[model samples]
Target: MKAVRYTLISGMLLLGMVFMKPTVVVSQCAMCSLNAENSTQHGNTQGKGLNNGILFLLGAPFLIGAGIGILWYKKYRTKSPKQTLLSHHS
Candidate 1:
């Protein structure tokens, strides 16, 4: 029960952080920055798209990992009485 409550609160905080993020997240390495700057200077939208795409890709893994972690916790949290007793004995 405590774990469930903590998980819910943590999930909500993560979501809030995600949703309230800054608009222009500069996620460029040296080479990437050079490329994006070159493209944007010529009025191409691809640079902006690239930056946003990178941001999205960066966030995807964390979200997936979080989901998998939540699922794993839910699955393993429900121990049978026998299993609980065995663990406690050890």
Candidate 2:
């Protein structure tokens, strides 16, 4: 176990040393404004359509629950306790 731990630590140190080189990248075109191209650009069209379909599927339950809750509130909001009891008795 101790040998394995020492080997792992030394491997990490060696990997770090191997990646420590810094190189400068020179670009000719001047840096443009931050908001130069704010338009939506998806390289894959099918992925966007699939995402919308999945979102609608996931949102269906919440929409149904909201509809049911609204209907329940409208059904119960305007009724009195006596009316509820009378309906249950029938």
Candidate 3:
């Protein structure tokens, strides 16, 4: 069952990566978008940097949450029934 779950997750991740588009999505407020556009129009390369920064910022929370979740899973899932019994009896 664990192997099946791992295989399924791996397949889904592989499929998502295969189908994912390599498009830049800058998630910012309207004013920020306008400012970025204006800067780009003025021949400044700051807009690209801003976009990359936004992507990094946007990804940080999800990465952190995933790390926390994996840690929690490892802590809870690694204990066998025999280990639990032995620990409690000591």
Candidate 4:
């Protein structure tokens, strides 16, 4: 229990630090990155939008997987009461 509590606290603190100041992470393939950079240099918003869309797509699967994992963990971690069979003697 103590280990679990400490782990949870540590995870929360790490997540807090991460969320405190968000930074943009490049999530583009080499060809896509080159194209986006080239288009942006020419003053086109399409490149910026493309980057944003890529970031969204990159984060979505992990976000969904994390959500599902959390749900599964919670569902299994909980303990349910067990029923006992009653036998009748004639």
Candidate 5:
């Protein structure tokens, strides 16, 4: 019963997310956008470089967090249940 309820909830959430329209997020502040626009108007490549740098900076934390989570899961998942119990007893 509990499993069915959880599955239903998960399905609902999944469908909701699938049906949702994605929003465009502006990562740059007004000043940054203006600077990039001005640079682009002058035909400088700095604006494109700056945008790439911003995207890299924005994505870094999520990548680091996913790496840490994967490492943690790998470290813990290799232990048997009996070994885990014995370790707690010690």
Candidate 6:
């Protein structure tokens, strides 16, 4: 069952990666060029900063959830509740 679940998860991840589009990662200064192109009418300075800040803020939850998920998964990957109780009782 574990092996089957792992296989299915791996297959899905592989499929997702294969089908995903190559999107440019707009991090920090890398977004300058993109902002310059679109910042004409809005003016460059405030718009650029706002856009970058918004993107940064938008990414916060995803980052937090991923970190939490890693820790949560690690916590459950080893022993069972019964084993923990038995160890305590012993």
Rank list by lDDT: 1, 3, 4, 5, 6, 2
- Residue-level lDDT of model 1, residues 1-90, one tens digit each, is 876998999899999999998876688789988988998899988988888888888998999999999999988886645457668878
Tell me the tens digit of each residue's lDDT in model 5 across 42-78: 9888887887788788988989998999899878875
Model 6, range 1-90, lDDT digits (tens) per residue?
876998999899989988895665445455765665577566656666666676788789989998999899988787634456668878
Off by over 4 Å in 1: 1-20, 78-90
lDDT score, candidate 4, position 73: 88
Q: Which stretches of candidate 5 lie over 4 Å from their true place?
A: 1-26, 78-90
Ranking by TM-score: 3, 4, 1, 5, 6, 2
- Model 3, TM vs. native: 0.64
Candidate 6 ranges beyond 4 A from true positions: 1-39, 42-45, 78-90
- Best-matching candidate per TM-score: 3
RMSD of each: 6.1, 24.1, 5.6, 6.4, 7.8, 8.6
> Where is model 4 more than 4 Å wrong at Cα?
1-21, 78-90
Error of 1 at 74 (Å): 0.3
Model 2, span 1-90: residue lDDT tens = 866997999899989977984553222223221122222243435434444565567779989998999899888776434456668878
- Residue 53 accuracy (lDDT) in model 3: 86
Clashing pairs in 4: none
Selected candidate, larger lDDT, 4 vs 6:
4
Q: After superposition, how far is residue 33 of candidate 2 from its true place, in Å?
A: 32
Candidate 4 has an lDDT of 0.84
**Which segments of candidate 3 are over 4 A away from where they belong?**
1-15, 18-22, 78-90
How big is the positional error of residue 10 in model 6, measured in Å on the Cα after superposition?
A: 3.5
lDDT for 69 in candidate 4 is 96
lDDT, candidate 3, 1-90, per-residue tens: 877998999999989987896775658879888999999999999888888888888888999999999899888886444456668878
